[model samples]
Target chain A: MKKDVPYFDKVHRWGRIWTLLALVALFSVPLVFSLAHDAWPEPGPFLKGLVAILPLYWVSGIIETFTYTPMIGAGGTYLSFVTGNIANLKLPCAIAALEKADVKGTSDEGEVISTIAIASSAITTTVIIAAGVLLFSIPVQWLTKSPVFAPAFQQIFPAMFGALMASYLRKHWKTAAATVLIGCIVVFFSPSIGIGILIVVTIVAAVLTSFLFYKISTKKSAAK
Target chain B: MDFKSNWLMYLLAAGVIGFVVVESLFFLVKAWKRGKELGISKQTLVNTVTNSAIYSVAPAISILATVFVLANALGNVLPWIRLSVIGNLQYETVAATSILSELGGSLTEEVTDPAKFAAVAWGMTIGCCLPLILVPIFCKKIHKKVGDVVNKSSSASALADVVAAAAFIGIIAAFVSKSINGIEVTKTLTGENVVSSRAGFLSIATLIVSIVVYLLLDTLATKKHLVKFSNFVMPIAMFTGMGAAVLMTQLLPQSLVLWSWPWLPPVQ
Candidate 1:
C-alpha cells in the first residue's frame, strides 16, 4: 500500500504529461491541414460557427468534468476526456468494469479498472472508425443504405439508455424516479433543449432530491 | 488537389488516428500494469478489456454511420478524423452545418472551396477541444475535493453515490423521453388527429424491449451466479432491442416510422 501511493502519484504525473502531449497532437490536426492547404479559415464565418457551439461545449465540458470525475476516478478521468464519448461509451464501461471487479469508484482498484475499461473502449472505437473510413464505399454504403440496418442504427440511443437505466435504477429509485419525471417533462415540452442543458438540469435535480431525501430520513429516525 | 477526396487527406487523417491509437494504448498499458500492482486479478482485468471492447462495437458502428453521413458533405477523411477524435456525430454535424450555412453553403452540397472546408473543420476542432484542455487542468483538484467530501462521513459518501446515480438516471431518462415522442398527438392534413412520431414509436418500443431483455438476463445471471454473463447483459440487451426496432419498423405502418422528428433534431 505504501508503494502503491507513489504509483498513483506517478500516474498523475504521467497522466498530465501524456494529456498535454495529446492536446498538442490534437490541435495540430487542424493546424497541419491549414498549413498543408495554405488556406486559413475565414474569420467571420469561423467565428460565427464557433459562437454557435462554443457556449454549449464549454458549459457541458465544465459540467461533465465535475459530474463525471468522482464517478470514474483520476486515471479514468484523464483518459476518458482525451478519448471522448463519456455518457454513452466510457462512463457505462467504467461502471460495468467497477461492478465486475467488485470495487468502489473511490477505491484504488476502481480507478485502475475504470481506466482500463475506458482505454480499451477508446482503442476499439478508434480502430473500428478507422476501418470504417478505409472501407467507406462498399461496407459503409451498405450499412447506411440497407433498409434492415437503418432502423437498428436509428434506435441506438434508446437501446443504450434502456439497458443502462435498468442496471442503475434498481438501487437509486428515489433519485431515478424524480429525475426521470423532470427529464420527461423537459424533453416532452421543450424538445429543443440540447443534451448539455438537459444534463445540467438533471444533476441539479438529483443533488437536491438526494439532500431532501437524506434530511427526511434523518428526521424520521430522530423521531423514532 | 481535389477538396473532396484526396490521398493526401487520407494520409493526414491516418496520422491523427495513428496518434490517438498510440496514446490510447499507452494509457491502457499503464493502467493495466497499475491494476496488477493494486492486486486486481488478471481475470478481472481481462474481463474489463474484453467486455468494454465488445460493448463498444455497436456504438462504434453507429458512429461509423455518422462518418458516412458527414462524408457526403465534408468528404470522408475529415469526418473520419473528426468522429474518431473528440467529436461525436451530433456535435460535428451541427458545427459543420452551422459554419457551412453561415458561409452561404449547404451540407447537402459538398464544400468545393478549400477555405470553406478549413473553416468548418477548424470550427469543429476548436469548439470541441475544450474538454481535452479543461480536463487535465482540473481533474486532479476536482477528484481531491470530491474525495474529501466523501471521506468526511458515511452519510456524505452515501449521498455522493446517490447523486451519481441520479445523474445517470437523468441522462437515461432524457433519451427515453425522446423515444416516446411518437405517441404525441398532432393535427394532420386530412383533419384526422394522428400520432406524429413513427420513429418515436420505434424508439420507445426498442427501449422497452431492451429494458425487458436486460432485466431478464440480469435476473438469470444473478440466479445462476454467472459472473461473466453479468458483464455482458447490457450489450446483449442493446443488440436485442436494436433487432426488435428493425422488426417493429417492418410491422408498423410506414407513416408511423419516421426518420426524424421536429422534437429530436437531426444531426444535420
Candidate 2:
C-alpha cells in the first residue's frame, strides 16, 4: 500500500505465462544437456537423483521468498509491494534475479528489497537442491547400485516442510503450542483414528485460544 | 511390501496421526467458542470444521493416490520401465546440484562449470514450492468467504472472527496433513534430532546473534528516543530468523544440515 511501491498492474502485467516461461527456462538447463548427451552413461542415476531432490528445491524456493521480504516493516507494512508479492507468491529465485538486474520499477525500497530477496532466493535454491541430492539421492545411489533412484526425493519434501513448520511455530509459539499439545493428546488416546484427531484438536485449540483472548480483552475494558 | 522403505511409510502414517489430532482440537475449540458467542448451535461449528476439511482435502488425496497407483502399475509392468514422462529433467537437477555442492564447497574448484550447474540446479528450484505459490491464490477466496460468515455474527465479531479463521485453518491443516502424510512422517522421523539438536544449535546461535544485532539496531532506532523505530526490532528479528535458515543451508553441507537422528522403534 505504500505510495512508492510499484503498482501490481505493472509487475504482474507480464502474466502467468511469463512466470511459467521463466520457470521453464530456469529448469530446462539440465534437460537440454541430457538431450545433447543422450549417451552420458545412464542418465537414470543422475535423473533419479534430481527427482529425489525436487521437493527440497521447491520448499526452499518458498522459504527464500519469505526470507528476503521485509514482511514486517516498521508499522507492519511490507517495504515494497513487488517484494511482498514475490514473497507471497513463493517465487524468490526469480525475485532475486529481478533484484540483481535492478529491473526498472516503482519505489526505491521495492527495488532494493527485490534485489536482496532474489539473491537470497538463488542462494537458498542452490542449497536446497544440493541438500536434496546428498541426503536423498546419494544414499539411495549408494544402496541401490542402480539408477532406479532412491526415495531421496521423498526426503526433500519433508525436510523443507518440517523446517518451514518449525519456523512458523517459532514465530507464533502460542498457537503452535496449542496445536501440538492438542494434536499429541488426541493421537495418544485414539491411535486408530488417523487424522480425525487433528481435526478435533485444531478446532478445540483455536476456539479455546480465541475465547481466552476475548476474555482477556473484555476484562481489560472493564478495568478501564 | 518392502520393509526397509516401509519405515518411511510408517513415519508418514504417524505424522498424519499427530497432525490430525492437534489440528482437530484447535478448530473445535475455536468454532465452539465462536458459535456460542454468536448464539449459533455448537454443532454448526463442528459441522464447519468437518465440512471444510472434507471439501478441500479429498481431491488432492485422490490425485496423490492415483499417482502412486500409476507409478506402481508402470513399475510392475515395465520391470525396467523408466517412464520418461517429464523428459530428461532429472539429469539437469542432479548436474545442477552437484555443481552447486562443488561451488559451495569452496573457492578452490575453479575449472568447474557455472552455467551447466545453474541449469541443473534450476530444475529443483521450485519443487514443493508450487503449492505454496498456488495455495495463497486459493486461500484468498476461502478467507473472504469465512470473513463473510464471521461478519454476519451479531456479538463481539472480532473474537468470533478469530475463532472462525482458526477453525478454517484447523480444518485445512487436518485435511492437508492426511492427504500429504509424506511430509509430516518424514519430519517426525528426522525431527527427533533435527528439532532438539540441530535446530537447537541453530536457534541458540541465532538467538545470540539476534540479540547483538538487536542491540546495535536499537541504538539507531532509539537514538531519537522515539518508540516508533524501536518497534522495528521484532520485525527485524523475525526477518533475520526467517533468513537464517537459508543462511545455514548456504554455510553447512547437506549432510551437516540434517544433523538430527533420534532413535525410535522400527516400524513393523
Leading candidate by TM-score: 1
Clashes of each: 2, 44
Per-residue lDDT of model 2, residues A56-130, tens digit only: 545444433332222211101111111122221122222222222223112223333332333232223223222
- CA-only RMSD, every prediction: 4.9, 19.0
Indicate the worst ten consecutive residues by lDDT in candidate 1 chain B: B182-191
B84 Cα displacement, candidate 1 (Å): 0.9
- Least accurate stretch of 10 residues (summed lDDT) in model 2 chain A? A73-82
On residues B27-112, what C-alpha lDDT tens digit does candidate 2 reach at each position?
A: 23432443354454444333333322322121112212222222221111111111111112222223333433433421122212
TM-score, B chain alone, candidates in order: 0.83, 0.27
Model 2 residue A51 CA deviation in Å? 5.9
**TM-score per candidate for chain A alone:** 0.85, 0.33
Model 1 residue runs over 4 Å out of place are A1-5, A218-224, B1-4, B181-199, B252-268
Our tally of clashes for model 1 stands at: 2
